[model samples]
Target chain A: MTMTDTNRQWRLKRFVQPDEILGEEHYELSESPMPTIDDEQILVKTLLLGTSPAQRMYVTEERTFHIAVEIGEVMSGRGVGVVMESKHPDFEAGEIIQATLGWQDYVALTPDDKSDTGKNVRTVQKVPNPVRPLTTIMGLFGQLAFSAYVGIIEVGQVKEGDVVLVSSAAGGVGSVACQLARIQGASKVVGIAGGQEKCDWLVEQGLCDSAIDYKKPGQDLAAAIGEHCPDGADVYLDNVGGAMLDAALQNIAVGARVVICGMISTEYMNPRPDGPKHYFNLLYKRSRMEGFFVFDYVPRWPEFEEQLREWYSQGKLKLVDDVFDGLPSAPRALGSLFTGGHTGGCVIRVADDPENIPAI
Target chain B: MTMTDTNRQWRLKRFVQPDEILGEEHYELSESPMPTIDDEQILVKTLLLGTSPAQRMYVTEERTFHIAVEIGEVMSGRGVGVVMESKHPDFEAGEIIQATLGWQDYVALTPDDKSDTGKNVRTVQKVPNPVRPLTTIMGLFGQLAFSAYVGIIEVGQVKEGDVVLVSSAAGGVGSVACQLARIQGASKVVGIAGGQEKCDWLVEQGLCDSAIDYKKPGQDLAAAIGEHCPDGADVYLDNVGGAMLDAALQNIAVGARVVICGMISTEYMNPRPDGPKHYFNLLYKRSRMEGFFVFDYVPRWPEFEEQLREWYSQGKLKLVDDVFDGLPSAPRALGSLFTGGHTGGCVIRVADDPENIPAI
Candidate 1:
């Protein structure tokens, strides 16, 4: 073959553990030129990226759903980028695009986000990031925000004076759920966090009415939820589904609602988790438990974004991001979620502005 | 205190397992010299009596709940008796009474049932048995029929062409649930039985569209449900919530509903059962699992009953009773549930007919 350079890419040479870096030299960068666009394709430049614990698990070859990345495959992630070139009528050159974009510096365009194509294809929606910080929308407000909103408001169906329990209370989805339950009129939000700091943060943010530190070894979460919420939890926003789901199951109030969001506890295991153990409490308490994927709420996003923005303007929906500052550090920050590295949303800083892409 | 003569009463002196009959010898028969009635009470004459597995499990001390006989308590059960004397306005002499009349030939005044001295203390619905069988109305049709009807029609919300899985398929609740599911628009019904005989009977009675012998070692029920149900089950009437529940969980189609009617498999354990290991399947499958106590649907009994009686009259509802003659074999029949010793509803033949007695 002729010596022609190629498209910019973050090639996944091998998987790494939590203690290991993705390596500065791990990614190979080259570009012959930008590709000519089609009527349906839009070329977008990488902007800010959202790192997830799932990505870390995916990278380590621990997760089952993922096919182990071959010797050279692009690192997977969801990110916000700016359209550099667009032939698609819906997208413009300068317009922003948010997608499950991989760790590459540049990615080709495709509207089929859910497909297995190498490009980070997704149902790209224009998230107006001018009113608030774009970083929040990219990090806290988008993925985690919608996760909490859909899980709590819709799935959990929280009501006024109702008690709510959120596992991984200081993490992305749980924190957002805690805040949303309060906004929606939850009487008491008891958070289950990893440490005193996180628990303290939860209570201080007014997101939680009380907090139980899981890091303290054994904080009888059921007892705490029972004590602080004498009425018992009407809505349980479960992010950590294994033991926390079991604990919440025991203390479920009559007609309680359990929102199954994610199970981070079992996500890192070689085998999936065993029984949550206390789910029979659902039968005894006459409660209902349901699961939801945030992507299922995309059509409702405009409505959610409107209400969420209103809450933000009213200081009801506060955003938090435990952002790491570099592409090389992305894997480490994302790994923190499973390894207890961060206390909030794990987001990676790819670029400060949409106009900062260097010429090839 | 003056002691009365030996009164005819069903007493549980000790707990016994299945096949071990707690015969009349195990009970101390007493003959009362016509006791006087008191305020808010009515004396009743001996009449028809039957038994249920719940009472059997309780009488045998093989259950988690405090279903103990208290060393000499009348074996708790439901029966239809005649009122000879009445001091309570709601109940009068010569009026028949139906409460959780403990396993006794004749009960004294005070229509107390549970711990409640007054609540749920009245006759559910006074009845004059005519043709189809009084005990059938009082036993199978009373709670058993209602259990199946309420679960499939009320909770499972069975729809036309919906596939339903009934665990403990040959037992009381399971057998009834299968029949009710078929009646309530279910096009396909699968019954998980303990043996080939039970499976054959289930299919013969048209209780299930398909049957699986759970007693067969190494039978993959999940695979069977998947194979038998190509579209997946829309409703699951689960009476045996154990490993079978795990299989059901895996085979549940998206939006499928699980009606947790009973958990016979795990009921006897001192410690609570560790349910299906893959319960989070509820989340993955976007399913809803709900448990309904038959007591909760009592108010709707008139509506439910009118329809049920209509079904029974139309020969739409199947009455499966494993009748054990006399109170001697009652405990043995009751204990048959755990061992899968009997098929359908089991009733104890206490009397040929009931007579109305006058109030004190």
Candidate 2:
């Protein structure tokens, strides 16, 4: 492949208002010279971009764990790329890697300054050779699957015979969570998803034993959960918060474990929305509710990778993605997460896989 | 004491509305023939009544974990008493015991039916010869202190140098939790109480390094928390859950432990009030918020008693109570919890301790 001078990026044009939906106007396609690599840097050619509600957070004016996306800067995001040129001793050309590469065609990961220590030190990690498709590496066997593993096994502690309930069940993290719960010997896996199609799709994949279509008119979600999980749920992996979480709270069994994975439902609501009114159920049922970030468990990724890779190879797990073609499709793909317009791992395919890329 | 036909009891005359304050109209002091003990029953003379906001719950029509108080029935409550008569093998006369004796001078404990298993089997426990005063046994060394022990030591897991923040800091559960957190090696303990007196009392006892009078005019609770817990709270033991919880939520450290011990603030609200609006902070800070009932930790009582008693002996822990005189004082004492009128353990001193009474 020949090196190109033109590098196109989806630059943040404005901060997203709390109540506003993301649009093309929020970000603009800007052309610039390709980023240069120093002796300690690696230039990466972006392939697939992962669209998550977390990406929307980067565009906000509020201070997050990392710096917010400023106007005229490439919108912060995560993507898997191939190393096109490298000066870093730890990286080489043609290697597949993953990092917070932003909404850009190329990412040059520079070395950390002397003051950078531990998590402050930024570096791209080489993607392991896949047992499944390379696209599955980013969706199921990679960051998406890694998040589910931490929530289900490490945080939720899903044990044998546990009845697992997942909100946003057909989405990126929830899909993997449902399968991971089943593989870990959950007696029943119940899923709550929007629309009849996603509900049917979840059960069709055998990811859930029962699925509740939350988008159905006049749906009493709490009653539906009771109908499916008569004994009440033992573990609830919550992604969509707001009213859905309140319904889940009512159906949790005594000593239930409610894992707070995400709150996409209320993320964009303006004047700080009301929280789960039934959170007192946490006391009444003697249950526990906890929130965690996947990065904290990064040091233990190899342990999760070993088990996940084995499960993928044994045909015990299914990996799927909702693909949006081309780089310009990023904005709509991300918005689909909040509106429940897409299922599985939402991926913006920036480019096709390189020829004869051998599986690990 | 001579047995008399005059069995004075406080019976629920009517259900107290959520917004209305408790009054004499809600309960009536009725006279009835003393309860007759059957062959498998024990008759007890009530002494001290432990009043709590939870007592207000019993009078409500809604069914909780336990049964609700019925009209014309003695109001459900917990108290210490002397066993006047016993026909059951497990009990005997003249022994001081504690049980859900209700707001009555005399109580007859009936044997459980064969089908009655688990928590349905009700029985009284003999009081140990406490190293502290007998009143203190029911307040600090009994259910109240046990709940605090489980929350602070077990759930919150207060470690050395941990900054502990407690809400309702002078109430039954909160008072003990504040002291217990300090005893567990917490470096800085900040308390949130309703008034200046309670705030001063919390700091005067040396239970907290700082105290925030939440009721003070123009006081910004979140800012006060920031001022006191400069490093952010490592463990937050929440009793009054509402806006105070929201304030504490905002100031939690990266890996803070939030122990939901009670939600007295919303227990009386008819429509069930909104919860902590800042609960999303759980996700941002990667913290764990868990609620627990003390009964679940009954198996670990001795573990708590050992530490509590040792601290009492060493004068490292101070146990205090707000005393109300006579039987008619029960309703008012319970109401005081909601109004934040009384601090420490709200105890209704029904009668004096009898001499030569052997403790079990």
Candidate 3:
């Protein structure tokens, strides 16, 4: 069978101003020759694409740990896909994989490429023992799940009888974090989300002991948290860091653990917003606020994967996947993360996996 | 020998507005009968009164961990005094003891009373083996030293080759912290202070590798810190937590530890100032900012005391005592802490130690 002649890609056309919307003006859709693989490489067919707030940092002119997504280049991101053709021994043509698959439908990954430097850092690996509903690879067993593990288990160190609070609790990582906190023996898991719908879903699905709809105008954030967590939060997994973080700070118990996973609230500001005005509460309560990157824990992903799989099999965990239709919907999927459009793990369904493997 | 007929006391008359000076208007000089000790209590003759910025909190109407200092009450404080007479077995005449002696010449410390509650909380104890220049007991080997121990060795976790930065580095806690960070094997210890004199003193005394005079007109604090800590600060011991904290946050290295010992810069403000604006750097650098109270580590004071004494005896540490004369100077000494007027541990020399004790 002959593959399509041209590759479709969403290239970052220019660095968007923080005040500007990340739309087609900043990103351009382009068609190019399909990427050719070498003897030690594999060509991947993208299946599912994950969207994260951190992606906003990639398109900025300022450089972070990874290089900025350059103008006229494929926007870098993580995704789940299947190996279409492989010249590498570790990967077969039908095997599923997850890596920095970027914005293209197809990607040529060199399994033996050791030159991941400044501007060229790619993490392409074959998925081991593929899970059913392959989106689980990106939503639960992949980077998203790994980040939640790092924040909940490592950073927050949630323990039995601890009152755990999570902000943006209906979002991708927040959803998994709430479940993980419960599985780790937290006596009370409280969630804070934007709308009543997401908040209702959190409590109804038993993901949290209670949920507070922060967008409910006239409702005080700290007061609501105090009402739900009578003893105050022992571990606060903060994804949205603005007024919500300030509120979390106010309701934290003495020696509370505040895990700064993401600051989605201030990510789009031109000159960053004023910091959490209640940060001094950290001093008053003798609490700790810490931040981390999931990449630091990449070496231990296998351990996290195994534990997550066990939790899933025992019916103690659920992956709330909110998948958009096709590759063209990827940008909107990413945009929706900022607009609070999705309830759980927001991902774009790129294409269907080959039917050679037996369905679960 | 018969002492004076009356006891001199400074009573809190009213809560001073943030803009007003903590002067005679806020306090009233009063005379009262010397406190009588019960059979289980010891009579203490106050010798050295230590003044701290935390005293401002005591005068506030707002209650925190401790109750507010009420009007007509003797100003609450910590001091070193001699046991004038003792009915309690734990104390003896001529022995130096540390306790919440308040702003009075005499204090009745009930060593065996054990009825300390609410506004009567007294942390009274006999000074073990008494370090020389007895002022050292209240300065370096007392709570000041304990705070530095917690900030430098415990919270900041200063280690070999770590570049440690400190704010208000000329004051009591910060001065000791600078030395402790160096003794803990920090390769570079930088300090930020007001005026050229204190900055020069820090470098001349080898207390800091370099010093930034924050009060220097038009100097960009972040740029100053960046220039001093070329590789960025590995640990930041924050005492003056306002703009200096924001600057420190901006110049921290990846994985840096920020120890928030105090926020003297905003303590007297009726409405607290905005928090450190560069706090998001904690997320960007994957760092940690933690706070601790010295009282929390009281059980470990023996360890800290032993180490501090050893360093003092070995000439590795020095107590930069900024002593004001007489009980009347206590309020000014406390006021100086916020005005950046004192170079070291500010204390009021209430009276001379008894001649029975040898002057070393």
The DockQ figures for the candidates are 0.57, 0.74, 0.75
Worst 10 residues of 2 chain A by lDDT: A113-122
Candidate 1, residue B340: the lDDT equals 79
State the lDDT of candidate 3 residue by residue for A228-249, as single tens digits: 9878899999898878898998
For model 2, residues B1-360, the per-residue Cα lDDT tens digits are 667787789999998888877767899998888898788888988888887666677787675645478888888877888888999987778888877788888888864442322543144667767443567776777788998899999999999999999998888888888888888899988889988988998898787788999999998989989999988999999888888888999899988988888888887787988867888888888888889887677667667787788898898887778888888888888778888888788888776666633211
Cα lDDT of model 2 by residue, A1-360, tens digit: 556688889998899988888878798998899999888888998888887777788788774645477789888777888889899888888888877788888888863442422443144667757443566776776677888998899889999999999999999999999999999999999999988999999999899998999889987999999999999999999898888888999899989988888898888787888888888888888888888887677777778888888898899887777888888998888888888888898988886676445221
**Best-first order by DockQ:** 3, 2, 1
State the lDDT of candidate 1 residue by residue for B1-360, as single tens digits: 122343456566766554454444555544445556678777765455555555645655554443456557767766666676677777766565566666655667565444543225344346544334655665455777778878888888998889998887777677778888887788899988888988999899888888988777777878877887778789988887878888888888878888888776665554666767777777767778887677667777667777877787899876787766665565566657667788877666665554322110
Among these predicted structures, which one has the highest lDDT?
Answer: 3
Off by over 4 Å in 1: A1-8, A14-36, A54-71, A112-121, A139-141, A218-226, A355-360, B1-7, B14-35, B56-69, B85-97, B109-124, B128-131, B354-360
Q: Against the true structure, whose DockQ is highest?
A: 3
Error of 2 at B180 (Å): 0.3
Total clashing pairs for each candidate: 17, 0, 0
* lDDT of model 2, residue B281: 81
Q: Ignoring the other chain, what TM-score does chain B have in each prediction?
A: 0.84, 0.93, 0.95
Instruction: Arrange candidates, best TM-score first.
Output: 3, 2, 1
* TM-score of predicted structure 2: 0.93
Residue by residue across A1-360, what tens digits does model 1's lDDT show?
A: 011123455666666653454444544433435455667887766666786544544566544334345547777677887787777777777777677667756677676445664322366766555443566675446777888888888878888988888898888777788888888888888888888988898888776878988767656766766776676789888777777788778888878888888777765554566776777777767777777666656778778878888888887777776877756676566657776667667777766564443211
Report the TM-score for the A-chain of model 3.
Answer: 0.95
**lDDT (Cα atoms) of all candidates against the true structure:** 0.70, 0.82, 0.85
